[model samples]
Target: MNKAPIVFLIGFMGSGKTHLAKHVSGILTGKVIEMDSEIEKKYGAKIKDIFSEKGESYFRELEREVLYEIIATNIHSTAPVLISTGGGTPCFYDNMEVMSGAGTTLYLRPSNIVLLRRLEKEKEERPLIRNKTRDEILEYIKQKVNEREKYYLKADIVFNPVNPDIGNLAQLVKEIIYSSFPYFG
Candidate 1:
């Protein structure tokens, strides 16, 4: 088995990191490690509960720890690992640097309008935007993305205005990675 770098997907909440990771996993020999799902499974508590009970600081600590553990495992594994991080993961705690060092980071940057539309539908499940009104969500996305762009831009590759077609994206990503590292047969 070829020891490929982990593929870390980062973006805003509604930017489709998880969805894209699933698509990419089909082409790569990687299992998906979705941060939020892992956290929920491990703690047996929803993220919103974790936030309300333990606070964001504690949640961030958990995120950092889980990320490090995943990276360590990836270091010893032959197969690639596709890690879909939470929307805020890259923006805090040297996460972007660590992920980039351990693997390939991809920023899925959909338009803010697209994010708003998607997020508005999933607001109830999203802790950060759950209580926000439509107008608030629009403004929130704009401000947060502006704040986080510096970190997101540090990724090895960025897919802006990502094509809505999952198959096309998976193929494109596969081609890019294989061409970049010609040793992969």
Candidate 2:
């Protein structure tokens, strides 16, 4: 029997990692492990609350733990596994290394303009940019993405588009998977 492959999606917030994972899951036929949701479930608090109460340092630590646990579970699972990770996951600690070592990592990079629009509407729910002004939010995204690009670029594959059209995204993802792992085809 062939063991399942762990597919990890990494990108900035509002880059549509979760949505992409959901779409890919339909094609791949596996459980989608959303890191943020898992963290909330395991810690009994939303990520914003965790960051507020315990600070980002604590949240990062918890994220690391949860990532490891998910990887362990994926190792034992018979079905293919897709992991939608938080924006900052690859930038923290040795997460990028761990993810690359364990599975195929895809970086879904959207333009700064796209990210600003998405994040602005949902900033209140996001701890890091919740307090920033519109201009600040845009600037922050530009700077943060520049800083994190190095880590994100280490992924096995990157879907860098100014604005990716969702209509054919699933088929595109399938192509990526087959190209990356020919045996999967």
Off by over 4 Å in 1: 1-4, 180-182
Candidate 2 lDDT by residue in tens digits, 1-185: 43347778899999989888777777775577899999999999999999999999999999999999999878766556779999999999999999988888989998998899999999999999999999999999999999999999999888876656664786687666666555656
- In angstroms, give how far residue 48 of model 1 lies from its true place: 1.8
lDDT for 164 in candidate 1 is: 70
Candidate 1: what lDDT? 0.83
Candidate 2: worst-modelled 10 consecutive residues by lDDT:
176-185
Instruction: Please give, for residues 1-185, the per-residue lDDT of candidate 1 as tens digits.
Output: 43345778899899998887778778875477899998898889999999888999999999888888888877755555678999999989999999888878889999998999899999988878889999999999999999999999999888885457888887777776555445552
User: In model 2, which regions exceed 4 Å deviation?
Assistant: 1-4, 182-184
lDDT of each: 0.83, 0.87
